[model samples]
Target: MTDFSGLQQLTSLIRNIEAQMEGAKLMILTHEHREEIARHMVEGLVGPSREHKVRIETSSGEYMNQLAILEIGGNKYTFSKDHQGMFISEINYYTCRITPNSHGILVYHQDYPGVIHDVSRVLAENKINISSMNVSREQKGKSALLVSLTDEEIPQSLLSRLQQLPQVQQVLSLQ
Candidate 1:
């Protein structure tokens, strides 16, 4: 009878420990899910983000990687990651530059010799550093140059000088 009583007491203690461990595991799983949710939220809102919802066509499972865009403007930016949510860790080592920032100032006209160099010279003469630069021309005479200047405040004189060039038709500061 004494041995049976000791076994019953030990069994009761073991049951209690098992119950507590189960509760702890539940708590841990809940915490992990919450952490994953929060990580995705921050990734969605930061930087110049454009979301493209897509899925992998594999037998494993369905998953989506949100394309996080870091636009340097004018088709150049660091590709952050393809994550299921906005989880901003530098874990994504992939990079890409697309759909560049043409918002600062766009100069358009017919393509001519010395136009690009002249534009640079004008900016250099005015002491404004070009933060970024892009040039595109199609078949025919159409041409466009996008420039991101260190100075947001572009002087009217510089704008006028660009317009005065024989081959140039339009000089517009986008943003």
Candidate 2:
């Protein structure tokens, strides 16, 4: 049997992101068990009254390491497995290596010096300690993503402050 414990959390994250958008669609491409995965994903994403707003599709393809590729809206994310463990290996178009059940903030910003410094300043002022951080970009001086795992829950106010920064384009708090 496939362990689907992580799927629940993934679905919740998707639901949160798609809460405001109407007629959301989720596409799941897996190497095997496409139907089973799609069923579980639907169960997690849809309620009785809201079934019509969401659509799910499953297909077979060769993705890296035989992991499932989940696409929502226009962003693509992957659940990957390796010797270390399972990780959320991709976000949007940026490559990442985030473990499950991590609590942090994902910042989409313009790539530049002092961007990280400004962000760190805000977190420091709020006393939110970052346990680990990963940054990825397609090229220099372009759009970039920063994932910061924090030691404490990031308040909405802090998220708003982060958003107000000049370099930041978007901020999403993950728990």
lDDT of each: 0.39, 0.73
Q: Tens digits of per-residue lDDT for model 2 on 1-175?
A: 6565555465565556553545556566565766666665566556424554556665556565535666666676676666665567788768877665667888999999999999989999989998888899989999999988888889999999999998899998885
Question: For model 2, how many clashes?
Answer: 0
lDDT of 1 by residue, 1-62 (tens): 11112212222222221222211110111222333332332222221253422111112212
Alpha-carbon shift of residue 68 in model 2 (angstroms): 2.6
Backbone clash tally (model 1): 6
Evaluated against the true structure, the overall lDDT of model 1 is 0.39
Score residue 58 of candidate 1 by CA lDDT: 16
Top of the candidates by TM-score: 2
Q: Work out the TM-score per prediction.
A: 0.40, 0.80
Candidate 1 displacement at residue 160 in angstroms: 1.1
> Poorest 10 consecutive residues of model 2 by lDDT?
45-54
lDDT at 146 for candidate 1? 35
Per-residue lDDT of 115 in model 1: 79
Lowest summed lDDT window (length 10), candidate 1: 21-30
In model 2, the Cα lDDT at residue 161 comes to: 91
